[model samples]
Target: MKKGVFLLCLALYAFSVTLTIFVQAAGIADEKLRLLSSFGSLISFFAVLAMLFLIFRLKDNKESKVKSCGQKQRKNPDEKNPSKEKYLEFAARNGLSRRESEIGYLVLGGLSNIQLAETLFISLATVKKHLTHIYEKTETSGRKEFAEKVKAF
Candidate 1:
């Protein structure tokens, strides 16, 4: 949508420039008016280009952040300290119900309580209850700490 608007603006600018040139050739537009029109056109074009460059840079930064987040998720670990899978396995090994495991995974995935409730077809109250039990069992403060602890697993 933004790109479309930009293109439309560029096209309108081109049309305006063409019209200005035609008017000047026909002796209708004065020299001062023509010079002002050219200056305005240059400023508008540079401004648009700068804006587009900034947008591209922002998009690239967002992509890099997403890639780094994925890399963190896929990091390999030695057999010594507990890994994320191990922590999850421990949760399962401790006889946590499958629903609780699902909740744990969602929490680890950075979903908020409301997001988890919507995704799991559960109520917000139920999500809170499950999260409380999860915190107690995992011995973590909240979701952010829970995710950090899981990262060590």
Candidate 2:
């Protein structure tokens, strides 16, 4: 009976040790998985950065090649619009919003307030409001003076 009891105790101890070893191994594997996941994220971040760098480098290279080949860079339409610079200057001096500046430029084109409202998809009252502001800023009495000033600019 003593021998049987001793053997049973030994079997229980061995089973407990085996379980502890497996638990420790699982913990090590978990740590390794976390490390691998962090590395993957870091690699992907650098890959994206590298791709952006390459894209910008290629764009600059193309621009330089164009310059070397004597191809004139296309001018923006805004640059060609003679009144655009004057409107920009007016906006800067008057602290006008972009929409107001656009409306002012259109007013200089001989369009009435009602026509402006219809063309810009706004109500007549809104157009009149913008015009009032524009007139005050430019110190103009009416459309004739505004057009004359813009043309002089």
Q: Could you tell me every candidate's TM-score relative to the true structure? A: 0.42, 0.43
- lDDT string for model 2 (1-153, tens) is 434544554555455445545556567557666565555555545545555665676667656643443322223323233457767886778777788888877665546666667567688999989888888888888877776666666
Best model number under lDDT = 1
lDDT of 1 by residue, 1-153 (tens): 656666665776676667666766777657777776677677667756755775787678657654543332322333133455786686876456778877787565556676666566578999999888888877888877776766565
Off by over 4 Å in 2: 1-81
Clashing residue pairs for model 2: none
Cα deviation of 82, candidate 1, in Å = 10
Q: What local lDDT score does residue 61 receive in model 2, on the 0 to 100 scale?
A: 64
Q: What is the lDDT of candidate 2?
A: 0.64
